[model samples]
Target chain A: MTSEQDPRPRAVIVACTDGPLLVRGEIDLISASGEAIPRTRKTVALCRCGVSTIKPFCDGSHKLVGFRTDPVPPADRKRDEGIVTGEEAPPDAERSGA
Target chain B: MVVCAGSQGVDDAPVRAHCVGMNAFDWARRSGGPPEILFDARGPLSAHLLDVLQRPVPESGEMLAALLPATEIALSQSVDVLRDDDIQLALFILYGLHYGQVLPADEDWEWNPSLITARLALEREFEKRLRSCVPMPALPEVDSDAVAGALFDLTAPDPGPSLSRYAAKRATPGQLLEFLVQRSIYTLKEADPHSWAIPRLTGRAKAAMVEIQADEYGGGLPERMHSTIFAGTMRHVGLDDRYGAYVDNVPALTLTSLNMMTMFGLNRRLRGAVAGHLAAFEMTSSIPNRLYGNGFRRLGYDTNVTWYFDEHVEADAVHEQIAGRDLAGSLAEDEPQLLSDIMFGASACLTIDGWVADDMLDAWSKGLSSLRVPLAVQSFATA
Candidate 1:
């Protein structure tokens, strides 16, 4: 287990079904061209390739380029939205007049 | 909650069974989910900020101790302060502390006087520079009714590429990604910047802001939360979705967009700007979102990929009216003195966003990458 005080920053990449990678944790995140940035935060997003107007973050650029290594159904995507909304609902059982 | 406006289902249900509400505009599809930080030795500026925030009276302390050098430089030059990427980045971090997106300097630092003094010092200049360029509308006699009208007048976007229109037609895959990256500064946190104004509002104005915000917040759904949906979009596209993940790539102008909103929302004196910003934001959202959806679909994306834009097409149609008339209008009616600031704030959103859009299109048009530097690929690369 790494302690939060560990001076060394290890970046983790979590994969989702739709767009860019979500990045968290301590990282220098220099550009591939090598510009040392001035920010020191616990989390930051970096662009996967040379795109992203928002730069270091993913803005669903893969879709624009047809970058498809992971192909998931649009249904799964809908369910994901449901999960996000459903969490706020007390319970599914409560919604229907059982 | 689900007012069926689009169509009815088999049981004569609303055709759009999907809530597909305002929360959709908040989502940005990224690729890699997000990373976790193991540990770190704090930077001097971030560390000092933490110390001050933890203090008993952060509202009156040395929040800018580590940043004095940069501050000195900002105080020295005119062209540098607004254009200097470093100064703007630093200022962005300092403000980020208060917004709760970045880690706190010290809990007490949230309101520390000296730290605020430092922030105020930077903001005084920042605001002056912003005001010089912001194009404030002429104020009518201060009254709630007059103020609202001014806000509506300001939100009418002047002719430009209509980035959304451009996105619908011309955006390449790379350009779309770049667009998302630029949007991350605000979308990752979604409605929070404007929520800062919630406490400052009263009666009808407060109610309107809350009504609009509630939809922005997915009406309490976590999955539906715009930020989370944006995170999903990030994962879909193979980018990082974590909050504050892309601070490095944003240029000063990009940071200024978010900073402007925070500046308006955070200050009680600028409540009108906050109202005006929201009004303008709502007014401008709809058609462009449709164009964005078309752009994604043109590239062969399924509804999942384009749903966020699709949702905005419907939601912001309703939101803009509420924001323009009820929120901004009512606030102006309640407090006419804020009219000019309200109009200025709306125009600021349009103006700053125009700069960001123009910068992106300019890069793409020139066959160039819009990011500060190209992302590294260990094996293969494109751009």
Candidate 2:
């Protein structure tokens, strides 16, 4: 498909063993202040903790602060189902068909 | 006006009110709240707002005028009131009435024809002024998918001192908390504003918005909800997290950012703008949030203080795609007419938000407070 016709969204989520999560390309980043970061050159990192030498991007701040993203237990984990089930009920009957 | 109408907190009310303007009964939310008399025509704006809202139907034009002085003023000025503190604050409050943030207005006014007329009239002027003042980015096509690309392009910030970069590197704890206070105006409301488009869209676009909003609402867990998470972050930093608690402390620029979103999301005609706005927003979020979290960490704050930013790092990475493709792209495919609007919305978000960020960073760089009233000026004893 041409770029315009492509419906599959693309993104890069890089997991760092001893540092911050490195992300690249089209992503939305709203700060705690509700401001959007204007587009940048397709690469960024997120600090897992408040402490990052890199400020906004993670420069291994989590390791210093001991941040952890423990994986959810098998049964409890929602398995990235691509959509949340039962969580979002439609508004009503009349507000259908857009 | 459907199942979701009742399933709301104060934040989501704007989404419900977006398609419709405030009616007489809806105006009651203004009474005895927030220092300023928000609506001021018949009684004080607040009192008249409540009086009209408690009624079952539309009030007279004079009554409507009392509750919507900002609207009247906006049309006459022809200047963008979206950033005017008085006008934006009042408009935000007016929209809040329809969202059912507090008690429901009188039942009869929910669909009052005359009240709707007044809202439409006000909105027309508000939008007209914005179009003239809010510079839009040059776009290639008016199609939905192309609109997404244009929006992405529009979100790019011009070179300078971005607040996130500064916060990460240099902000003091007190300064950081103050910044968070300005953000609380919208972050506390989180995804409710954008959710308004869910009912106004269909197919890919509708699904896309729901996909992103579901995460924003924190799936099923109330504590994990973005708004709830933000409140936790606020409490971590010793700021008040209750809704509208710090409304007075913020300046017009802060209020305008949200007013723009509400204005974009509430108007169905601007659905593409909402989508593009969201896309541009998400596309730019992940990195700065990381910096924000780190900035707090650098100040010796713990994970609790940074969870909001951390959460965005993960959530928005996923949301960016959902927003860009499913929401914006899908919308363009469904309604080709909105392509230019979508582009316009995204660019508007970037330009307006850039202006505010620059304002905050510039103030900090100059060693001045960014809030409307500086922190030192407010006496704790009286407050």
Candidate 3:
């Protein structure tokens, strides 16, 4: 969490369509109860499709579960840096921060 | 020792003398190593290729002369080229030349025109057969998300009599060893076939591939490399961990699985297919790996034996995303024309590997060994 003054390190989480949410950058993944998630790899796919046997981290269970987002095609998804995402984009000034 | 061992193709003495320059008999005696020669000739092409690798390649002119007849004979005789053990083995050996330690041939032989000619002759037939066999999937719009979505769908887990499920519940210890033996052909050389595509790609796609491969390669820890981890699992299961140790045991279909990747990877024209192949491969890996690990655990094996599969459970979770979106998907975004080939590559992987799995499961269900050679002895089993 960022202080009132200092900004949080911008972590981009892309909610991949019919798939897990891919979180990039240095992230301190944790549970709702504040338990820290152990991560070995830098970028992680968090289980948005709750059926993943491995909780928190995805093991690609979404396809079997038929996870879907909006019916809108990917062309409408906002582009951040180079990655096109299903989520809304940051403000133009914030996009320029990188 | 396994490096020098090509299983059965060429004569141990001459090939070793030619390649390693050791007194083959003495080295054999002192080391008590695995059989370190080219394979026993399975078919005409393989017989001819083994013969070529045995001889020094300055004799390529003569090698070429002898090879053409065999290549021509094999090509002419083949109907279902995919299952032709002779041609597949020949291709496997040819590609093995690029990955050192599998074939005991001199370095000069890799680029020898005659060998390339033979490999290409076989590959053209093999590629033709593959293209005919697996019709390409419908092309998605050339955007990263669209392409990635298509790849994800193509690779989604099947709801059927699956090999992983069979392994998890039914396979015996002997069957487990056979599983390792069948898998040894590819798992030992993990990430290598696809790594060939790294230099072929550029920008986000290339970077994405590099990212996934870096993890596959153990992130600078050589011992932790997926291939090394696989080798460790082999050692745990009391199987030979050395590369090509089990090449003799696997059937043509198993070789075809790897050979397909090599064909895709080695040819720049099929670069998109290779990317898609890796995506489908990674996409399909994690969940099955979980079941595969459970299969070994059901047999009462410890973590040492299952770590390779366990590692894949997490590693490929991350990899599938990169491979689906950043690699294959991004590659499609860059080269719109390659989108179709990319889908073909993914389908071909599922089709070929699906067949391989069915072969194993059917063999197991029949109470038989899946490997070409029934594991006659468990070397690590204390009698």
Best by lDDT: 3
Each prediction's DockQ against the real complex? 0.01, 0.03, 0.14
The candidate maximizing DockQ is: 3
- Tens digits of per-residue lDDT for model 2 on B1-383? 11212111223434433312233223333332322222232213334555566554544456765655534655466445556655555555556656643234554554566456546665676677667867877755645445545554454323345677677778876678678878877887788778877898888788768867876876767777887778767654545454555666677777777777877888898998888888877766765677777788887777887878877765665565557656777777778788778777776777677777777778887888888766532211110
Tens-digit lDDT string for candidate 1 (A1-98): 55787766576654422233444445666768899764322223344533444455443233233333355478765643433211111110000000
Ranking by lDDT: 3, 2, 1
lDDT of 3 by residue, B84-158 (tens): 888888899899889876767777888877778888888899999999999688889889988888887676654
Clashing pairs in 3: B5-B36, B8-B39, B8-B40, B9-B38, B9-B39, B9-B40, B10-B38
Evaluated at residue A6, the lDDT of candidate 2 is 85
lDDT of 1: 0.58
For residues A1-98, what per-residue lDDT tens digits would candidate 3 score against the true structure? 35566576557787877777888877777889999878777778888767777778887565554456766456544321243221111101000000
> What's the distance in Å from true for residue B157, model 3?
2.3
